[model samples]
Target: MIGMLVTFTPRSGTFDRSTLEKIAGELRGPFDGMPGLRFKTFMVDEDGARARNFYVWEDEEKGRSFFTEELVEKVTGIYGAPPVIEYLDVVGFVDNSAG
Candidate 1:
């Protein structure tokens, strides 16, 4: 499995919690059934002025392919900042929902 963390730090006045919530709401459905994606979560750190997305994919190729340069540019326009993306080897996972 592969895990990806994409973090965005918007400019001080460009984003707020409400905006983030709206974005998440609009995107949730499309991502839910995406091929090769196991699960994804949109998260925020209000105090830190950051928004983060965590995604677990079936494989490294799927995870890496999703974060293309064009996607990054598009999101940078929406978030008002470029994201810092990191990929990790998922050494461990637990999904109680599966039960």
Candidate 2:
């Protein structure tokens, strides 16, 4: 399995509530259709300027595909510049429910 974490600053966090709604719509729409995607999670704080994305894919290629040239260009167009990301291998997970 492959894991990815991304942190980026946006061009403007001034999307307003409506713009956020639109983004949400797009996430569930064409954007989610990106290839090689397996799982995704997004984190945005109340500060409204910074965002983080955590992703998982079947392999390194899939994980890398998320940052495709086209995707990067389009994302930069809306969000700004580029995001710094780290690719990691998941070591282990703790489970307590069974205990």
Candidate 3:
């Protein structure tokens, strides 16, 4: 499976916290269920300023799909326009994230 890591910097320091949560929440079912999609995630920068973050996509085609999907436009409405996204292959993952 192909994996992807997307990171972005928001336009400014004006991003909303709940908005980010809602965005992460909304993507759960839609993108997760798509063909070649294994998992995904994202977070705003820790400084609570710039948004340098990442998420994983399971396959190359699925990675490509995000841009082609109509949902890209929807995200801008909530998260602001044109955030930079990066794609990558997972060499490893350590999900020690506390539940």
Candidate 4:
């Protein structure tokens, strides 16, 4: 599996608990059954100044294929800032519930 971490700083006065929940609600349906997507988790700082997305993909190519310029722009537009995207080789993972 491949892991991806995307972090971004939210624009001034643009992020809050309500907005974060709204974003999560909007994403639930479309991302539920994406091809090559194993899992995804969204996180934000308690102060709502920053956010991050953690994704696990079936493979590196699949992971890379999902990040497009349009998507980047969309995220940037939503948060009012660009994101820093990082790809990593998933050396190991542990899921207790799956056991």
Best by lDDT: 1
For candidate 2, write residues 5-75 as lDDT tens digits: 87667665533445545655677665375565666766665676766668777677867766887877776
Order candidates by lDDT, high to low.
Answer: 1, 4, 2, 3
Backbone clash tally (model 3) = 1
Clashing pairs in 4: none
Q: Which regions of candidate 1 fall more than 4 Å away from where they truly are?
A: none
State the lDDT of candidate 1 residue by residue for 65-97, as single tens digits.
998899999889878899999999999999999
Q: Which candidate, 3 or 4, has the higher lDDT?
A: 4
**Candidates 1 and 2: which is better by lDDT?**
1
What TM-score fits each model?
0.90, 0.66, 0.66, 0.88
Task: Sort the candidates on TM-score, descending order.
Answer: 1, 4, 2, 3
Tens digits of lDDT, candidate 4, 1-99 = 999999888656646778777887888787898888989988888877788889999878989888899999998887678999999999998877676
Clashing pairs in 2: 11-79
lDDT of 3 at 4: 49
So what's the TM-score on candidate 1?
0.90
Superior candidate under TM-score, 1 versus 2: 1
